[model samples]
Target: MSIWWSLHLRRDAASVPLARRFLLGAMETAGVDPEISFDLSVALSEACANAVEHGGDRRVQREQSVGRDPWDVWDEPAGTACGQYRVTAYLDGEKCRIEVADSGPGFPARRMLRTSAQQHDPQLYPSLSAEDGRGLCLIEQLADHVHFGNRPGRGALVSFDKVLKWRKGALLMVS
Candidate 1:
Protein backbone atom coordinates (compact mmCIF):
# COMPACT_ATOMS: atom_id res chain seq x y z
CA MET A 1 0.00 0.00 0.00
CA SER A 2 1.02 3.59 -0.59
CA ILE A 3 0.28 6.65 1.52
CA TRP A 4 0.87 10.32 0.77
CA TRP A 5 0.10 13.80 1.99
CA SER A 6 0.78 17.40 1.05
CA LEU A 7 0.56 20.64 2.97
CA HIS A 8 0.53 24.29 1.96
CA LEU A 9 1.46 26.19 5.08
CA ARG A 10 2.07 29.77 6.07
CA ARG A 11 5.65 30.58 6.89
CA ASP A 12 5.09 30.62 10.60
CA ALA A 13 6.80 28.90 13.51
CA ALA A 14 3.70 26.97 14.50
CA SER A 15 3.46 25.38 11.12
CA VAL A 16 6.68 23.51 11.74
CA PRO A 17 5.23 21.27 14.45
CA LEU A 18 1.97 20.97 12.61
CA ALA A 19 3.76 19.50 9.64
CA ARG A 20 5.91 17.27 11.83
CA ARG A 21 2.99 15.96 13.82
CA PHE A 22 1.00 15.17 10.73
CA LEU A 23 3.86 13.24 9.22
CA LEU A 24 4.52 11.36 12.43
CA GLY A 25 0.90 10.40 12.77
CA ALA A 26 0.73 9.17 9.23
CA MET A 27 3.85 7.04 9.65
CA GLU A 28 2.69 5.58 12.93
CA THR A 29 -0.74 4.76 11.60
CA ALA A 30 0.91 2.92 8.74
CA GLY A 31 2.98 0.85 11.19
CA VAL A 32 6.30 2.30 10.13
CA ASP A 33 9.09 1.54 12.60
CA PRO A 34 9.33 4.12 15.35
CA GLU A 35 12.99 4.81 14.78
CA ILE A 36 12.45 5.64 11.12
CA SER A 37 9.46 7.75 11.96
CA PHE A 38 11.37 9.71 14.60
CA ASP A 39 14.30 10.40 12.36
CA LEU A 40 12.08 11.57 9.54
CA SER A 41 10.11 13.75 11.90
CA VAL A 42 13.23 15.55 13.09
CA ALA A 43 14.43 15.99 9.52
CA LEU A 44 11.04 17.34 8.52
CA SER A 45 11.17 19.86 11.35
CA GLU A 46 14.52 21.16 10.18
CA ALA A 47 13.34 21.54 6.62
CA CYS A 48 10.20 23.37 7.66
CA ALA A 49 12.16 25.67 9.93
CA ASN A 50 14.49 26.52 7.07
CA ALA A 51 11.53 27.40 4.87
CA VAL A 52 10.04 29.61 7.54
CA GLU A 53 13.30 31.41 8.19
CA HIS A 54 14.72 31.79 4.68
CA GLY A 55 12.30 30.99 1.90
CA GLY A 56 9.49 33.52 1.50
CA ASP A 57 10.82 37.02 1.98
CA ARG A 58 12.29 37.35 -1.48
CA ARG A 59 9.19 36.03 -3.13
CA VAL A 60 7.07 38.56 -1.30
CA GLN A 61 9.34 41.36 -2.41
CA ARG A 62 9.16 40.22 -6.02
CA GLU A 63 5.40 40.06 -5.88
CA GLN A 64 5.16 43.57 -4.46
CA SER A 65 7.47 44.89 -7.16
CA VAL A 66 5.07 43.57 -9.79
CA GLY A 67 2.19 45.49 -8.15
CA ARG A 68 0.58 42.28 -6.91
CA ASP A 69 -0.17 42.06 -3.22
CA PRO A 70 1.41 38.98 -1.73
CA TRP A 71 -1.66 38.19 0.31
CA ASP A 72 -3.81 38.08 -2.76
CA VAL A 73 -1.25 36.26 -4.81
CA TRP A 74 -1.00 33.58 -2.19
CA ASP A 75 -4.71 33.57 -1.49
CA GLU A 76 -3.85 33.71 2.17
CA PRO A 77 -6.44 34.72 4.69
CA ALA A 78 -6.18 38.15 6.27
CA GLY A 79 -3.36 38.73 8.78
CA THR A 80 -1.66 35.53 7.66
CA ALA A 81 -0.01 36.71 4.44
CA CYS A 82 3.60 36.27 5.47
CA GLY A 83 4.30 33.69 2.69
CA GLN A 84 3.88 30.03 1.85
CA TYR A 85 5.79 26.78 1.69
CA ARG A 86 4.91 23.30 0.50
CA VAL A 87 5.68 19.91 2.00
CA THR A 88 4.92 16.62 0.34
CA ALA A 89 5.42 13.09 1.61
CA TYR A 90 5.00 9.77 -0.12
CA LEU A 91 5.35 6.27 1.27
CA ASP A 92 5.39 3.16 -0.86
CA GLY A 93 6.28 -0.20 0.61
CA GLU A 94 9.46 0.44 2.61
CA LYS A 95 10.53 3.55 0.74
CA CYS A 96 9.62 7.05 1.81
CA ARG A 97 10.19 10.37 0.07
CA ILE A 98 9.65 13.91 1.18
CA GLU A 99 10.08 17.30 -0.45
CA VAL A 100 10.00 20.80 0.98
CA ALA A 101 9.79 23.79 -1.36
CA ASP A 102 9.61 27.48 -0.66
CA SER A 103 8.80 30.58 -2.69
CA GLY A 104 11.72 32.77 -1.70
CA PRO A 105 14.93 33.41 -3.59
CA GLY A 106 16.31 30.06 -4.58
CA PHE A 107 19.75 28.99 -3.46
CA PRO A 108 22.75 30.34 -5.32
CA ALA A 109 23.58 27.83 -8.02
CA ARG A 110 27.34 27.86 -7.55
CA ARG A 111 27.14 27.56 -3.81
CA MET A 112 24.52 24.85 -3.98
CA LEU A 113 26.65 22.78 -6.33
CA ARG A 114 29.69 23.19 -4.13
CA THR A 115 27.78 22.35 -1.01
CA SER A 116 26.33 19.23 -2.56
CA ALA A 117 29.82 18.04 -3.33
CA GLN A 118 31.05 18.67 0.20
CA GLN A 119 28.08 17.49 2.23
CA HIS A 120 30.07 14.81 3.97
CA ASP A 121 32.21 17.44 5.66
CA PRO A 122 30.14 19.43 8.09
CA GLN A 123 32.98 21.93 8.37
CA LEU A 124 32.05 23.21 4.94
CA TYR A 125 29.01 24.82 6.57
CA PRO A 126 28.71 27.73 8.94
CA SER A 127 29.18 26.94 12.59
CA LEU A 128 26.30 26.05 14.88
CA SER A 129 26.66 29.42 16.60
CA ALA A 130 25.35 30.89 13.40
CA GLU A 131 21.57 31.07 13.36
CA ASP A 132 20.98 29.29 10.04
CA GLY A 133 23.51 26.63 9.20
CA ARG A 134 22.61 23.38 10.89
CA GLY A 135 19.43 22.28 9.19
CA LEU A 136 21.05 21.07 6.00
CA CYS A 137 23.63 19.13 7.93
CA LEU A 138 21.03 17.44 10.07
CA ILE A 139 18.97 16.54 7.03
CA GLU A 140 22.00 15.08 5.33
CA GLN A 141 22.82 12.87 8.28
CA LEU A 142 19.28 11.63 8.77
CA ALA A 143 18.06 10.94 5.24
CA ASP A 144 19.42 8.10 3.15
CA HIS A 145 19.22 10.18 -0.02
CA VAL A 146 19.24 13.96 -0.27
CA HIS A 147 18.88 16.52 -3.08
CA PHE A 148 18.97 20.28 -3.16
CA GLY A 149 18.04 22.68 -5.95
CA ASN A 150 15.91 25.63 -6.90
CA ARG A 151 12.65 26.37 -8.67
CA PRO A 152 13.98 28.53 -11.50
CA GLY A 153 13.87 32.14 -10.25
CA ARG A 154 11.51 31.30 -7.47
CA GLY A 155 12.54 29.40 -4.31
CA ALA A 156 14.66 26.62 -2.91
CA LEU A 157 13.76 22.93 -2.88
CA VAL A 158 15.09 20.24 -0.52
CA SER A 159 14.16 16.62 -0.95
CA PHE A 160 15.16 13.45 0.84
CA ASP A 161 14.18 9.83 1.08
CA LYS A 162 14.88 6.81 3.24
CA VAL A 163 14.32 3.10 2.89
CA LEU A 164 12.79 1.80 6.09
CA LYS A 165 13.48 -1.52 7.76
CA TRP A 166 10.69 -2.97 9.79
CA ARG A 167 11.34 -4.32 13.26
CA LYS A 168 11.79 -8.08 13.45
CA GLY A 169 8.47 -9.85 13.60
CA ALA A 170 6.51 -6.63 13.36
CA LEU A 171 3.38 -7.29 11.39
CA LEU A 172 3.03 -5.28 8.21
CA MET A 173 0.09 -2.95 8.47
CA VAL A 174 -1.19 -0.59 5.80
CA SER A 175 -3.82 2.05 5.97
Candidate 2:
Protein backbone atom coordinates (compact mmCIF):
# COMPACT_ATOMS: atom_id res chain seq x y z
CA MET A 1 0.00 0.00 0.00
CA SER A 2 1.18 3.48 -0.75
CA ILE A 3 1.95 5.61 2.26
CA TRP A 4 0.31 8.89 3.10
CA TRP A 5 2.67 11.84 3.34
CA SER A 6 1.81 15.15 4.99
CA LEU A 7 4.05 18.13 4.47
CA HIS A 8 3.90 21.80 5.35
CA LEU A 9 5.67 24.33 3.23
CA ARG A 10 6.24 28.04 3.63
CA ARG A 11 4.16 30.11 1.25
CA ASP A 12 6.38 31.78 -1.27
CA ALA A 13 6.79 31.63 -5.03
CA ALA A 14 10.22 30.08 -4.59
CA SER A 15 8.71 27.32 -2.49
CA VAL A 16 6.75 26.19 -5.56
CA PRO A 17 9.70 24.24 -6.95
CA LEU A 18 9.98 22.39 -3.66
CA ALA A 19 6.30 21.54 -3.77
CA ARG A 20 6.69 20.01 -7.22
CA ARG A 21 9.72 18.07 -6.11
CA PHE A 22 7.83 16.71 -3.14
CA LEU A 23 4.86 15.65 -5.24
CA LEU A 24 7.06 14.06 -7.87
CA GLY A 25 8.88 12.20 -5.13
CA ALA A 26 5.63 10.91 -3.68
CA MET A 27 4.36 9.91 -7.10
CA GLU A 28 7.54 8.00 -7.82
CA THR A 29 7.56 6.35 -4.43
CA ALA A 30 3.97 5.26 -4.84
CA GLY A 31 4.83 3.78 -8.24
CA VAL A 32 2.31 6.04 -9.88
CA ASP A 33 2.15 5.74 -13.66
CA PRO A 34 3.99 8.30 -15.76
CA GLU A 35 0.80 9.74 -17.18
CA ILE A 36 -0.71 10.17 -13.75
CA SER A 37 2.49 11.67 -12.47
CA PHE A 38 2.35 14.13 -15.31
CA ASP A 39 -1.17 15.12 -14.36
CA LEU A 40 -0.21 15.53 -10.72
CA SER A 41 2.78 17.59 -11.65
CA VAL A 42 0.79 19.92 -13.83
CA ALA A 43 -1.94 20.35 -11.27
CA LEU A 44 0.47 20.90 -8.41
CA SER A 45 2.48 23.35 -10.49
CA GLU A 46 -0.58 25.41 -11.22
CA ALA A 47 -1.62 25.47 -7.58
CA CYS A 48 1.81 26.44 -6.33
CA ALA A 49 2.16 29.03 -9.05
CA ASN A 50 -1.08 30.55 -7.93
CA ALA A 51 0.21 30.70 -4.36
CA VAL A 52 3.37 32.46 -5.41
CA GLU A 53 1.66 34.93 -7.67
CA HIS A 54 -0.92 35.72 -5.05
CA GLY A 55 1.54 35.76 -2.17
CA GLY A 56 2.41 39.37 -2.74
CA ASP A 57 3.70 41.87 -5.24
CA ARG A 58 7.00 43.13 -3.72
CA ARG A 59 6.38 41.22 -0.49
CA VAL A 60 6.98 37.82 -2.06
CA GLN A 61 10.63 37.79 -1.21
CA ARG A 62 12.60 34.69 -2.28
CA GLU A 63 15.74 33.83 -0.41
CA GLN A 64 18.73 32.88 -2.55
CA SER A 65 21.14 32.37 0.31
CA VAL A 66 23.26 29.29 0.97
CA GLY A 67 23.37 27.62 -2.42
CA ARG A 68 19.84 28.42 -3.54
CA ASP A 69 18.45 25.56 -5.65
CA PRO A 70 16.86 28.26 -7.84
CA TRP A 71 13.78 26.10 -7.58
CA ASP A 72 12.89 26.48 -3.86
CA VAL A 73 13.95 29.76 -2.31
CA TRP A 74 12.99 28.73 1.23
CA ASP A 75 10.46 31.14 2.67
CA GLU A 76 11.58 30.53 6.28
CA PRO A 77 8.61 30.81 8.69
CA ALA A 78 5.14 29.61 7.86
CA GLY A 79 2.10 31.97 8.01
CA THR A 80 4.54 34.80 7.59
CA ALA A 81 4.40 34.69 3.85
CA CYS A 82 5.33 38.27 4.28
CA GLY A 83 2.91 37.47 7.10
CA GLN A 84 1.97 33.78 6.92
CA TYR A 85 0.94 32.55 3.52
CA ARG A 86 1.40 28.86 4.20
CA VAL A 87 1.09 25.96 1.81
CA THR A 88 0.31 22.45 2.86
CA ALA A 89 0.47 19.24 0.81
CA TYR A 90 -1.20 15.96 1.60
CA LEU A 91 -0.61 12.72 -0.28
CA ASP A 92 -2.35 9.43 0.42
CA GLY A 93 -2.65 6.45 -1.88
CA GLU A 94 -3.90 7.83 -5.20
CA LYS A 95 -5.36 10.90 -3.52
CA CYS A 96 -3.65 14.27 -3.11
CA ARG A 97 -4.79 17.45 -1.43
CA ILE A 98 -3.07 20.81 -1.60
CA GLU A 99 -3.99 23.97 0.24
CA VAL A 100 -2.61 27.42 -0.34
CA ALA A 101 -3.33 30.18 2.16
CA ASP A 102 -2.44 33.83 2.29
CA SER A 103 -3.07 36.72 4.64
CA GLY A 104 -4.77 39.01 2.20
CA PRO A 105 -8.16 39.86 0.82
CA GLY A 106 -10.31 36.97 -0.30
CA PHE A 107 -12.06 36.53 -3.64
CA PRO A 108 -15.62 35.59 -4.46
CA ALA A 109 -15.75 31.97 -5.56
CA ARG A 110 -19.03 32.33 -7.44
CA ARG A 111 -17.82 35.32 -9.39
CA MET A 112 -14.61 33.54 -10.19
CA LEU A 113 -16.41 30.51 -11.59
CA ARG A 114 -18.83 32.61 -13.59
CA THR A 115 -16.00 34.65 -15.07
CA SER A 116 -14.13 31.48 -15.95
CA ALA A 117 -17.07 30.12 -17.91
CA GLN A 118 -17.55 33.41 -19.72
CA GLN A 119 -13.86 33.47 -20.62
CA HIS A 120 -13.30 29.85 -21.67
CA ASP A 121 -16.78 29.14 -23.01
CA PRO A 122 -15.40 29.83 -26.55
CA GLN A 123 -18.82 31.16 -27.52
CA LEU A 124 -18.02 34.35 -25.66
CA TYR A 125 -16.91 37.36 -27.71
CA PRO A 126 -13.18 37.61 -28.35
CA SER A 127 -13.22 41.17 -27.11
CA LEU A 128 -14.15 39.88 -23.64
CA SER A 129 -11.09 37.70 -23.32
CA ALA A 130 -9.53 37.54 -19.86
CA GLU A 131 -5.82 36.83 -19.60
CA ASP A 132 -6.36 35.71 -16.04
CA GLY A 133 -9.27 33.88 -14.32
CA ARG A 134 -8.34 30.70 -16.17
CA GLY A 135 -6.34 29.25 -13.27
CA LEU A 136 -9.37 28.19 -11.22
CA CYS A 137 -11.02 26.65 -14.29
CA LEU A 138 -7.92 24.63 -15.08
CA ILE A 139 -7.65 23.68 -11.41
CA GLU A 140 -11.26 22.57 -11.26
CA GLN A 141 -10.70 20.37 -14.28
CA LEU A 142 -7.65 18.79 -12.61
CA ALA A 143 -8.95 18.35 -9.08
CA ASP A 144 -11.99 16.43 -7.94
CA HIS A 145 -12.61 18.96 -5.14
CA VAL A 146 -12.02 22.68 -5.40
CA HIS A 147 -12.90 24.84 -2.43
CA PHE A 148 -12.31 28.49 -1.64
CA GLY A 149 -13.11 30.35 1.56
CA ASN A 150 -12.07 33.20 3.79
CA ARG A 151 -9.66 32.67 6.72
CA PRO A 152 -11.41 35.31 8.81
CA GLY A 153 -9.18 38.33 9.27
CA ARG A 154 -6.18 36.47 7.84
CA GLY A 155 -6.91 36.10 4.14
CA ALA A 156 -8.11 33.16 2.06
CA LEU A 157 -7.49 29.50 1.51
CA VAL A 158 -7.79 27.54 -1.72
CA SER A 159 -8.08 23.80 -1.33
CA PHE A 160 -7.89 21.21 -4.09
CA ASP A 161 -7.92 17.44 -4.14
CA LYS A 162 -7.39 14.79 -6.82
CA VAL A 163 -7.53 11.06 -7.16
CA LEU A 164 -4.81 9.66 -9.36
CA LYS A 165 -6.92 7.03 -11.09
CA TRP A 166 -9.62 4.48 -10.56
CA ARG A 167 -13.11 4.76 -11.94
CA LYS A 168 -12.68 7.72 -14.23
CA GLY A 169 -14.70 10.84 -13.41
CA ALA A 170 -15.51 9.49 -9.98
CA LEU A 171 -16.75 12.12 -7.60
CA LEU A 172 -14.65 13.03 -4.59
CA MET A 173 -15.97 11.19 -1.59
CA VAL A 174 -16.38 13.47 1.43
CA SER A 175 -15.88 10.68 3.91
Candidate 3:
Protein backbone atom coordinates (compact mmCIF):
# COMPACT_ATOMS: atom_id res chain seq x y z
CA MET A 1 0.00 0.00 0.00
CA SER A 2 1.11 3.61 -0.59
CA ILE A 3 0.30 6.47 1.71
CA TRP A 4 0.98 10.17 1.33
CA TRP A 5 -0.18 13.40 2.88
CA SER A 6 0.78 17.05 2.81
CA LEU A 7 0.08 20.09 4.95
CA HIS A 8 0.36 23.82 4.42
CA LEU A 9 1.09 25.49 7.70
CA ARG A 10 1.46 28.99 9.06
CA ARG A 11 4.98 29.70 10.22
CA ASP A 12 4.11 29.52 13.87
CA ALA A 13 5.72 27.60 16.73
CA ALA A 14 2.57 25.58 17.29
CA SER A 15 2.75 24.18 13.80
CA VAL A 16 5.85 22.18 14.60
CA PRO A 17 4.18 19.77 16.97
CA LEU A 18 1.11 19.66 14.79
CA ALA A 19 3.19 18.50 11.85
CA ARG A 20 5.02 15.92 13.97
CA ARG A 21 1.77 14.53 15.29
CA PHE A 22 0.43 14.06 11.81
CA LEU A 23 3.48 12.03 10.82
CA LEU A 24 3.30 9.96 13.98
CA GLY A 25 -0.36 9.24 13.39
CA ALA A 26 0.27 8.16 9.85
CA MET A 27 3.18 6.00 10.86
CA GLU A 28 1.26 4.40 13.69
CA THR A 29 -1.70 3.67 11.49
CA ALA A 30 0.62 1.96 9.04
CA GLY A 31 2.12 -0.04 11.90
CA VAL A 32 5.62 1.37 11.54
CA ASP A 33 8.15 0.53 14.22
CA PRO A 34 8.05 2.93 17.11
CA GLU A 35 11.78 3.60 17.08
CA ILE A 36 11.68 4.56 13.43
CA SER A 37 8.60 6.64 14.02
CA PHE A 38 10.31 8.47 16.85
CA ASP A 39 13.38 9.26 14.79
CA LEU A 40 11.37 10.59 11.89
CA SER A 41 9.17 12.63 14.20
CA VAL A 42 12.21 14.26 15.76
CA ALA A 43 13.59 15.06 12.33
CA LEU A 44 10.26 16.43 11.20
CA SER A 45 10.10 18.66 14.27
CA GLU A 46 13.53 20.12 13.52
CA ALA A 47 12.59 20.89 9.96
CA CYS A 48 9.31 22.46 11.03
CA ALA A 49 11.04 24.50 13.72
CA ASN A 50 13.50 25.80 11.18
CA ALA A 51 10.64 26.71 8.90
CA VAL A 52 8.92 28.61 11.73
CA GLU A 53 12.07 30.47 12.68
CA HIS A 54 13.65 31.18 9.28
CA GLY A 55 10.87 30.99 6.75
CA GLY A 56 10.73 34.57 5.58
CA ASP A 57 8.06 36.89 4.33
CA ARG A 58 8.92 39.08 1.38
CA ARG A 59 7.68 42.12 3.27
CA VAL A 60 9.69 41.15 6.29
CA GLN A 61 12.75 40.62 4.11
CA ARG A 62 12.28 44.04 2.59
CA GLU A 63 12.04 45.61 6.02
CA GLN A 64 15.28 43.95 7.08
CA SER A 65 17.00 45.04 3.88
CA VAL A 66 16.31 48.65 4.76
CA GLY A 67 17.81 48.44 8.29
CA ARG A 68 14.81 47.26 10.29
CA ASP A 69 15.51 44.34 12.56
CA PRO A 70 14.08 41.02 11.33
CA TRP A 71 13.00 40.14 14.85
CA ASP A 72 11.20 43.44 15.12
CA VAL A 73 9.20 42.57 12.05
CA TRP A 74 8.36 39.17 13.49
CA ASP A 75 7.46 40.76 16.79
CA GLU A 76 4.55 42.44 15.09
CA PRO A 77 1.16 40.75 15.21
CA ALA A 78 1.20 40.16 11.45
CA GLY A 79 4.39 38.14 11.46
CA THR A 80 2.79 34.88 10.38
CA ALA A 81 0.30 36.34 7.96
CA CYS A 82 2.38 35.85 4.85
CA GLY A 83 4.79 33.26 6.13
CA GLN A 84 3.87 29.71 5.26
CA TYR A 85 5.53 26.36 4.70
CA ARG A 86 4.63 22.89 3.46
CA VAL A 87 5.29 19.45 4.83
CA THR A 88 4.73 16.33 2.75
CA ALA A 89 5.18 12.68 3.60
CA TYR A 90 5.16 9.56 1.48
CA LEU A 91 5.21 5.92 2.46
CA ASP A 92 5.65 3.32 -0.25
CA GLY A 93 6.86 -0.24 -0.02
CA GLU A 94 9.84 -0.25 2.34
CA LYS A 95 10.61 3.43 2.72
CA CYS A 96 9.06 6.58 4.05
CA ARG A 97 9.99 10.04 2.77
CA ILE A 98 9.23 13.44 4.22
CA GLU A 99 9.69 16.86 2.72
CA VAL A 100 9.50 20.35 4.20
CA ALA A 101 9.48 23.44 2.04
CA ASP A 102 9.23 27.08 3.01
CA SER A 103 8.53 30.36 1.31
CA GLY A 104 11.52 32.05 2.93
CA PRO A 105 14.72 33.11 1.30
CA GLY A 106 16.45 29.89 0.26
CA PHE A 107 19.85 28.72 1.32
CA PRO A 108 22.86 30.63 0.05
CA ALA A 109 24.40 28.95 -2.97
CA ARG A 110 27.81 28.66 -1.39
CA ARG A 111 26.49 27.14 1.82
CA MET A 112 24.23 24.81 -0.09
CA LEU A 113 27.10 23.45 -2.13
CA ARG A 114 29.30 23.12 0.94
CA THR A 115 26.62 21.37 2.92
CA SER A 116 25.78 18.96 0.11
CA ALA A 117 29.42 18.01 -0.10
CA GLN A 118 29.82 17.60 3.64
CA GLN A 119 26.47 16.05 4.48
CA HIS A 120 27.95 13.10 6.32
CA ASP A 121 30.67 15.01 8.10
CA PRO A 122 29.29 15.67 11.55
CA GLN A 123 32.48 17.44 12.60
CA LEU A 124 31.92 20.11 9.96
CA TYR A 125 28.93 21.42 11.87
CA PRO A 126 29.50 23.24 15.12
CA SER A 127 28.69 21.67 18.44
CA LEU A 128 25.19 22.46 19.69
CA SER A 129 26.45 25.46 21.60
CA ALA A 130 23.58 27.60 20.35
CA GLU A 131 19.92 26.81 19.93
CA ASP A 132 19.32 27.54 16.25
CA GLY A 133 21.79 25.88 13.89
CA ARG A 134 21.55 22.19 14.64
CA GLY A 135 18.36 21.24 12.82
CA LEU A 136 19.76 20.38 9.41
CA CYS A 137 22.53 18.26 10.86
CA LEU A 138 20.14 16.49 13.15
CA ILE A 139 17.83 15.70 10.26
CA GLU A 140 20.72 14.27 8.30
CA GLN A 141 21.65 11.96 11.15
CA LEU A 142 18.13 10.58 11.40
CA ALA A 143 17.17 9.98 7.78
CA ASP A 144 18.81 7.38 5.57
CA HIS A 145 19.04 9.90 2.77
CA VAL A 146 18.51 13.67 2.63
CA HIS A 147 18.52 16.42 0.05
CA PHE A 148 18.62 20.19 0.53
CA GLY A 149 18.00 22.68 -2.18
CA ASN A 150 16.12 25.83 -3.20
CA ARG A 151 13.09 26.56 -5.34
CA PRO A 152 14.72 29.56 -6.99
CA GLY A 153 13.05 32.73 -5.65
CA ARG A 154 10.45 30.72 -3.80
CA GLY A 155 12.29 29.23 -0.81
CA ALA A 156 14.29 26.38 0.67
CA LEU A 157 13.40 22.69 0.50
CA VAL A 158 14.57 19.94 2.78
CA SER A 159 13.64 16.34 1.84
CA PHE A 160 14.54 13.16 3.63
CA ASP A 161 13.69 9.45 3.59
CA LYS A 162 14.26 6.40 5.71
CA VAL A 163 13.94 2.68 5.21
CA LEU A 164 10.91 1.63 7.19
CA LYS A 165 10.90 -1.10 9.80
CA TRP A 166 7.48 -2.61 10.22
CA ARG A 167 5.86 -3.52 13.51
CA LYS A 168 4.83 -7.15 14.09
CA GLY A 169 1.40 -6.61 12.65
CA ALA A 170 2.17 -3.91 10.13
CA LEU A 171 -0.61 -3.37 7.70
CA LEU A 172 1.75 -2.28 4.96
CA MET A 173 4.49 -4.81 5.37
CA VAL A 174 6.20 -5.52 2.08
CA SER A 175 7.32 -9.05 2.80
Summed backbone clashes in each candidate are 0, 6, 1
TM-scores for every candidate against the unseen true structure: 0.79, 0.62, 0.81
Question: Candidate 2: what lDDT?
Answer: 0.58
Please provide, for model 3 over 84-172, each residue's C-alpha lDDT reduced to its tens digit, 9 standing for 90 to 100. 78899999999999999876777767554334567667677867686567887788889888888887666778999999999987999
The residue-level lDDT of candidate 2 at 22 comes to: 80
Residue pairs clashing in model 3 are 56-104
Provide the lDDT at 140 for model 2. 68
Off by over 4 Å in 3: 60-81, 113-123
lDDT of every predicted structure (CA atoms)? 0.78, 0.58, 0.80
Highest lDDT model number: 3
Which number leads on TM-score? 3
Write the candidate numbers in order of decreasing lDDT.
Answer: 3, 1, 2
Off by over 4 Å in 2: 1-11, 56-84, 112-129, 166-175
Q: Please list all clashing residue pairs in model 1, or write none if there are none.
A: none
Flag the better candidate by lDDT, 2 or 3: 3
